[model samples]
Target: MHDAASALNPQALAEAAGAAMYARDTASQSLGMKLIEIRPGYARMTMPVRADMLNGHLTCHGGFIFALADSAFAFACNSHNLNTVGAGCTIDYLAPGRQDDLLTAEAVEQALAGKTGIYDVTVKNQDGRLIATFRGKSHRVSGEVAPVQR
Candidate 1:
């Protein structure tokens, strides 16, 4: 399964991967998440904390923040076009996200071995306040993101 799709250069692979995933990512799109940056084993995305995203406490719900982090993790782990899925993940909230705030999540690969990998995601608000920290474990499945020269 170590094919050209997996062997593509970092930038090219990131482009291809994002193109493939973004086309089918209705969840991220519907949430108004935007891809800011992407590279091999790395991705950054932003989501706006809309009024509807606020909870009873008048802060953005943790689930929305988690989704932003998870989305970044998904992109980072799948940057190689290896078709990865989350095996497990955990997130810690550090600060509250307020309405009208733009939240950005950046994910970076921490390690990779065999079919499993680890990624760390940091969520922040527009004011440079840390909102959450997330760790994701990924399992690669058999597939190609797009056609690639051998």
Candidate 2:
């Protein structure tokens, strides 16, 4: 398994990871998250702020924004073809998200050491307004994301 993994190129690994993860990700699909781009240690995703996702203040709920960021982080950390899971995460809201807004989240890996990694996701609106920033720590477990050629 390790030899098969090591034999795959970086881009091949990322593509396989994305395909495998998307096939099993129901929550992201159910929430209407659109995957824009993915590569090794990076991912971009978009979500529309729907009316059903609004809070009492008539703005998009913080939870929905956090979810979008989290999904982006998950994809970024897992792009290495490892079965990685989030160990911890944090988000800070900068601006209120409104209904009908197209929010895009871009996540990038900050550090990877041993079995742990750190990622940062920036959530922004279509108008380029920052909505939130998220940080996620990931832990890679013992599994391959997909079969690879040795």
lDDT assessment of candidate 1: 0.92
Question: Model 2, range 1-150, lDDT digits (tens) per residue?
Answer: 335655478877887788788888999988889888999999999999999999999999999999999999999999998899999999999999999999999999999999999999999999999999999999999997877776
TM-score of 1: 0.93
Looking at candidate 2, what is the lDDT of residue 4?
A: 67
Candidate 1 weakest ten by summed lDDT? 1-10
Runs of candidate 2 with Cα error greater than 4 angstroms are 1-7
Which residue pairs in model 1 clash with each other? none
Q: What lDDT is obtained when candidate 2 is compared to the true structure?
A: 0.92
Which window of 10 residues has the lowest lDDT sum in candidate 2?
Answer: 1-10
lDDT of each: 0.92, 0.92
